[model samples]
Target chain A: MLTTIVILLYICVVLFDFLPSKETRSTKERVIYCILLTVSFCVLILYSLDIKVPGPTEPIRNVIETLFKPSK
Target chain B: MQKEMISARQMFCIIIMFIFGSSVIMGVSSGAAQDSWMSLLLAAVFTVPMLLIYARIIKLFPEKNLFEIIEMLFGKIAGNIIIILMVWYSLHLCALVLRNFSEYIQIVSMPETPQLPIMIAMILVVVYMAKSGIETMGKWSIAMLSAVFLVVIITILFSLNKMDFTNILPFMENDFKSIAAGAFRLYAFPFAETVLFLCLADAMKKKDSPRKLYLYALLFSTVVLLLVILRNLFMMGPGMVGASYFASYVAVKLIDVADFFARIEGFISMNFILAGIIKITVCLMAAAKGTARLFGINNYRKLLLPVSLLAVALSAIVYKNVMEMIDFLRFYTYYAVPFQVIIPLTVWIAAEIRMHKRKLA
Candidate 1:
């Protein structure tokens, strides 16, 4: 049910927000927009399904830890 | 594209609100315990030179934002690499703050609801604000900052009865290392976060002094944050404050005026929302601007929705839970050093060199 809602919301966003302004955007703008939208859409759907999409926090934490180990 | 301009006063208000963003509710530098007040002061003092550098950068490049300045300074390949780092930083910061907002609401008020809905609602509002551009954001900050100040004053006044003066006794018990660590955390998270304002510096009128605007805002925010830290420390004491996740909210919850006025912790929530919106909007605008500059787009507004969507998704998965979020704060100071200090220092040096060369010519 949550997954369905997520899909519907993105659809509404694309239809209402993107489609209306499609004509004004340059080709590069459209391509970048679609790329961002698609990536976020996939991540949101995966999240809703409890699929555990990888986030940047873990790698960032690891890198910080490696560089600056906590003093016990 | 037409340039957006905000008065110096509006920029000051925006900076204050942005500094108060998540730090006020999260209770900055709690690692220093009762000496957090000292840590806060130390953080403000340490931030002064960095703030001056940021102001100088803005003065050097009056009409260009950070993205344009980077591209101009570094050229295509190197500048784009730096721009990508900055865009990631801005986007990640936006997501982190958004996650902080949702987590606070979920744990404090609405435990049953999932975080995605809260994040979505916030991103929508933030996107609208970003789409409106800096002028609207500046005006909004001016109006909302007054309400934020009123709430802070009211909460402080109401909670005065419960505040025990001795709670901060035996001050400076912690060693310099501990206090310095806490100060670094406070400086990285909130004080230096003002670096984001440089991304929007193009909006400030040429007549307004960036140095004056930044210093005034930093002074005002530091004082306000100090008062808030004192209030929390006096009410909750050092141990409880360190143990609690949301110290300000917990501190405000203890407010009782003859049993008639109580449970006004909602005021902290109000403060967070007002300030957090401006903070998120600023970050989103910066990220959108960076993305547009990367793709050679004229208007950043066209990318707001997509960037906002990505932010929402990222915020949803930023951490597994609030504990991880809080734990991340420890490492955040180090992670932020590159973007907050190193990059700006390099930019300032390069800019100085370029200016000197031009003068010689």
Candidate 2:
């Protein structure tokens, strides 16, 4: 139910907030906007479904741990 | 809209508030524990040179932002790649700040409230402020900074009775290596994060010196951070501070001056809200502008809504829980070094070489 509401809200945002300015935007801007919106929509859906989305900071954390091991 | 310009004072206030953003609530340089105040001082000193490089880059380029300057120095293809990286950095940083605020709110107040709605509401405010443009942001910063200062001073005064100055004994217990690392972490997280302001360098009024602006802001934030660290140390002591996720909030909780004036930790939340909004708005504006630049779009406002939504989504998924958030913060200094230090230093060098070539020609 939560996922459905979120999806509907996203569609409304894409149709209203994002689509109205499409005529004024260049092809590049429109493509970038669509890509970003799609990615965000997917992430939100995954979030609402209780799926674990991998954080971007994991790689950095691994590298830091390797370089600077905590002293006991 | 004509190019919006902010006065030097407004820029100063924005920089101070940005540095204070989440750091004030979470505590700074915690690796040194009792010595974190010293770590903050060293971090502030280290940041001066980085600020100088940033100022020099802006002064040399006159009115170009970091993205424009990157393109001018690295050529179109390489510059666009770097620009994308910078935009990603800004967006990711915005998400991290958003996550910090959401987690903080979840922990302190509204334990039962879902994180998603809180994050969405915060991002909406940030989007609205970003769409209003830099001029309004500068004005808001001035007002917010003053209010934050007053609250901080009052909180400190009230908490003085509970503080124990002797709690900071055995100052250098953490070896020199750890202390130095702590200083570096402090420098990168809050100090070097000022690199984002490079994107807004062109927004300053023509008469203002970017050098003075950077120096003044650094000094102001440094002093504010130093006082905050000292206050936390005096109140919570080293062991309590190092153990807690939000040391400053914990310290603020100790401020029970009298029966009539208790539960003043709400003021800390207010401070966080004011500073957090400014920080997120600035990052959102930078990300949107960088995206617009990437796509050759004339107006950045067109990209704000989508970029902000992406930021909110990223914030929701940034960490599994508050524990992961704390763990990531331990390594944030290392993660941010390349974007915060390496790129700006390289740009400064490139700008110097280019200026020399033009002078010769």
Candidate 3:
């Protein structure tokens, strides 16, 4: 599937971009960078697999609608 | 930490483009229908004080962006918390804009193409721009503003034939309360969204005054937006304008000058893309910079790709359909107040106090 290929391409690009610069950065920097990278990859992979992730907008929407509803 | 600085003129262009990001295409403050122009004008006038507040905050610490200012004022932990919140806000805004762009493109140009590829391609450009640094984004804004303005002017001229000045006749039809609410909605959106610019203030040259930059940009954008709204009002009237998702694009679709000069809405789409990119790029850059500061990293570019990818995914999942997106926007005026106004006002007051203390010392 095209989704699998796009996910693979993304992983390859992230590795190619970040791995070579690993030695130049501090451990803290590398950890944060990897954490961010891993998070992005996980989200994209989940999306490619057609797995739904709950978003934060829904709760905000609920609260707004409740608070601003027209009163009869 | 960006070494290259942009002149005030470049800042002006970026601000104008940023405000016009998705508003011009989607129709800002359309709650007032035919009177949306009045809403936008009132919003612009009301924004002058808020603009001064932002300018004064930056002037208080000429060398610092909003992130550094927060860190300095609030100390490390509290400051990082605020920065994280801001980063979240910026990413959320970027996602919303990306979704808007993809939806517009899908509806107008490519009906069959899946949104994933379009969104991926757009995020790629945004990541590259964010990685290239703030000065490059500023320079691009300068070059693109001329073309954007040219498209606006031409669209206005060509669409003049379809415009009916009488369509806007029965103004104030919504009563004073609704119009004021509409003005407040407009204020919360495009006008007040300039708070994000505080993140890029340090990128402006030392000689460039933030007040002038904000004022000039606000005034110019208001004029162009008024013209765009009038075109939509006169061409589509209040009825169809409110019914359509992208009112300006629909209005331009009615332009048929001598039957040879039709389908010129593509230029408006071009304007949309240019402004959208600048807006998203700035948001991504701000989020990345905030992340870098939070993690004590030297370069923000390291996080640009990941953050932008996150934004792309968020855009995909934000709303189920365009109608949902519009519905959220209708409430966005209220939801955005905390980030857009309250937080910035807090920072401005803190900055003023700090400045007074320094003067006394």
Candidate 4:
């Protein structure tokens, strides 16, 4: 899935950032890294966005449900 | 000049806040209830000496991280085995705790989302924090701890009208036998896991008195967690509290001060942001630090990505379903006790023996 690819990309960036370098990196490199991290997290959130939960349709039913529902 | 990393004081606060917030909203509130509050108290009392042992280890080797200490104390082969086990434990604990909260969100909020995406997003933030290093974790935790403390106090104030002390009633209804059983199992989990702080102690900026930090963190976590647990028990009642998966979230949802300002668990979830990130960051840090020491690398950050992906893969593979995950915790409570409590105690004794001999010499 697209989500999987995004996560893979994120992992790459995170691991690369961990490498200890002899010289300070260019700002461009840092920006690209940040961009990549943000994009992947965004993709992840959107992918999860479709997780719709059904709310109570009727108030009376909701009250009744709460009263009777067993502990989860 | 470079910014100083976290001090032992700040690290102590970070560990306490993160651990208290951890799974507190998920499992602890559900199982302990009024009795859960008792569990927190029990955990504190039991962990006090364990904390002292940890302090002794730190005091003896103020400059050495745990992996190196093990290497020094036990020699390379035996030390490597202990390090590997600790790494596995930290990784699995991170995954386990992540799943614990993800399951909570599934139960109470987004029911249709797969657990992986939720967990991955979380791991990313933690990876970022871990990459940044320990000082960030400390500052973030303080900001978070303050916010969560306020929310908890406000929730208690609003819910005072609803609390029924008699709910924890008949104190020993199950008797000391049952209480002790719960204590023996739950004690090491969120409480004694503080042993992981051994890694953090080495990173402290100024000298820290491990005894003071341990006692303060233990006392503070116990008090706040007990309040939250007691609130859940009185607010939800014993039977409901015992059975519910996340009694604290449910309790927070029920907070209706004047019937308009409500659902403060949302604010607390922001705090969850810090705790979740800290949990994973600390786990990764421990694993990386252990790896670096074992391989004798100069640094740990290089291992972060490989380890994160591995953790993600392993987390996905760890349990078949949320039920399996839940069952893991139930079983793991008993399984983790000896390792969390007993192994550390054994190591402490060994360390002590070595220390005494060193002193005599």
lDDT tens digits by residue: candidate 3, B1-361: 4465777887898899999999989877448887888888889998999999999888888867899999999899989888998888898999999999999999999998877788888988888887777778888999999898888789889988888999998978878767777788889888998999888777877677899889999999999999988888888899988889999899888889998989988888999999999999988888888888888886778778778877887887888888888878767877888888888898998888888899999
CAPRI band of model 3?
A: acceptable
Cα lDDT tens digits, model 4, A1-72, are 646665676665556553454245445444433443464355344543543222112332345345544222
Encode model 2's per-residue lDDT on B158-208: one tens digit a residue: 988899999888878888888777888889888899899988877976677
TM-score of 4: 0.82
Poorest stretch of ten by lDDT in candidate 1 chain B: B23-32
Clashes of each: 0, 0, 0, 2
Model 2's alpha-carbon lDDT is 0.87
Model 4 residue runs over 4 Å out of place are A6-72, B1-4, B27-33
Name model 2 segments beyond 4 Å from true.
A67-72
- On DockQ, the candidate that comes out on top is 1
Give the interface RMSD of candidate 4.
13.9
TM-score of each: 0.99, 0.96, 0.96, 0.82
Q: Rank the candidates by DockQ, best first.
A: 1, 2, 3, 4
Between prediction 1 and prediction 2, the one with superior lDDT is 1
Q: Candidate 3 clashing pairs?
A: none
Could you report the Cα RMSD, in angstroms, for every candidate shown? Answer: 0.9, 1.6, 1.8, 9.0
Candidate 1: give the clashing pairs.
none
